[model samples]
Target: MSAAETAAETAAETATRRTPGLVPVGETLRSAERGPRQPAADPGTPPARMPWSFWRLLGSELGLTFRRPRNLLMLAALGVVPIVIGVALRVVAAEDGMGGIIEDVAGNSLMLTFVSFSFLVLLFMPVVVSVVAGDSIAGEAGAGTLRYLLAAPSGRTRLLAVKYVNAVVFAYAVTAAVALPALATGLVLFPAGDVTLLSGTTISMGDGLLRIVIAVGYVGAGMAALAAVALAMSTFTEVSIGAIAATIVLIIVCQVLRAIPELGSITPYLLPTRFTNFDAVLRSPIDTAAMGEGLLAFGAYILLFGSIAWARFSGKDITS
Candidate 1:
């Protein structure tokens, strides 16, 4: 073979080796004609989060909250407690000569509501609200669903807002649970009439019913306060029980402290400690001025705690 042919073969081999995984120059040029593919996006920007879509989010929470045994137990207790109280009042009044069966029957509506809700606000309502609200986020996290929720198309802010609303709504629902049945039973057992006011005035049955409904509204406000506190504590705990326990303990302690008599003037400011006084509703005229103040204070506490909880929830890792 001639030196010229040999040199030409060597050059060809070198050129091929230099272009690893190379196609023909013509093919390479043709491929380059197609522009870069969408810049090979990095894991996508992650579509904006839309956490709260009202009915949608509430439906999700309702399904989960009802699954809770604690909530079921609360419902049972809500029913049972009032009936027991009614029977007790029936017996006690008989012995004390407060009234006969007819009078008792007439008074049952307002009386039973007063008794049942008093029991709830003093303990059961707070516990129920805390358990449900507190567990909302933290429980989801514990169950390993928090991360999935965070990653969902819903925005984090909206998501947390929905959760917060769910907590408040659940609080109202659970709190009202005892009220409805108790009132119904009382009305069946006792005769109802215009509420007797503190000032020796009487409100017709219609007016009394309206006042009672108004009281329910105020109590709902109280429940919202409890829900806010529970939701805040919930952010601190992965176990819903932890949030529940903390709220219960705090409430009990505050209540005990407020009952000290000497704490009288300032006690009502303790938010959940001295708020609901049923007398305000049954009296001659609605006298909610005091409770209104307490409600304002409770509102402040709820807002403060709720803000912190939301901020924390927004920043949490949400691994689960």
Candidate 2:
């Protein structure tokens, strides 16, 4: 062959070698036509972090909780108790038939408020809290929303904390719902003045109002412990009703055990044991010792169940 022909053949061979052998040039062009493909995500790689806003979660939860018809009805029902009690006392004072029930509604309306609070804290507060805290987790799971929520960038622990905090806030809100109405009704229907203490001493009206505020706060704190436990129960089940029922049942069991004379030794440790210790605030000199113990117990329970909720939620399988 001539030198020019040899060089031309060598150039053709090099060009052929440079091009793909199996895939045609047309196929390569088509692949290029398709834009760059993303690499598959590494299974072991952590997801991109999302900025979690505590206030946003809290606002959303609170908005959802209060907007529900049933929850609204429950809160309204709580507000009604004081109205009924106040009205009943107003009538009873005129008749003078019920002596043991309320000694002096006509003289000191503050007593009526205290009585209403006592009745509220016993059952109403717990029931109200159960509705919120009990449904916090189980409702999400049962509604098939928990999986999506967990899939969000927010960590499970942070989500649980938000739920727990929202439940506690609801507890306080419900307590205030009861107290404010009672105060308003008492001031309107009955006369408000100095309050007579159970210890046979009297406190000025301003001092009395302060004590009432403290009492309401104490009641809210006591219910917060129940709310925490209810949240833990919520984590264990997907049925909101089941969690609520279980929490109420637990309250009943504790109350029954507390009332049993035989179990007096252990009853002191029960949840409902010092629930009424808020009354100690009404004493001429406040009974901080009793209130302190009650608050401490509530704090301890909050820590115990809150930890359980975090552990369960963090490791939970998102099947739903």
Index of the highest-lDDT prediction: 2
Identify the leading candidate in terms of TM-score: 2
For 1-320, candidate 1 gives per-residue lDDT tens digits of 99999999999988767443323423333333432345554676773233335568768777777777877787677777878777677666565446543343445466577667766787877777777777877887788776566544455566667788887777667757777777777886666775555466777878767766877777878878878888888888778788888988988988888879987887856766644754577665556776667678778988898898877765554444
All candidates: TM-score: 0.77, 0.82
**Candidate 2 C-alpha lDDT tens digits along 1-320:** 99999999999988778432233323333342442466778999875443446678778988998788988898889899999999988877787466654665566767767788788887778988998899999999889887666545455666788898889888988888888898888888877778778787888889988998998899889889999989999998989999999999999998888878998999868888878899898786899999999999999989998888877766565545
Give lDDT: candidate 2, residue 196.
77
lDDT of each: 0.70, 0.81
Local distance difference test, candidate 2: 0.81
Minimum summed lDDT over a 10-residue window in model 1 is located at 21-30
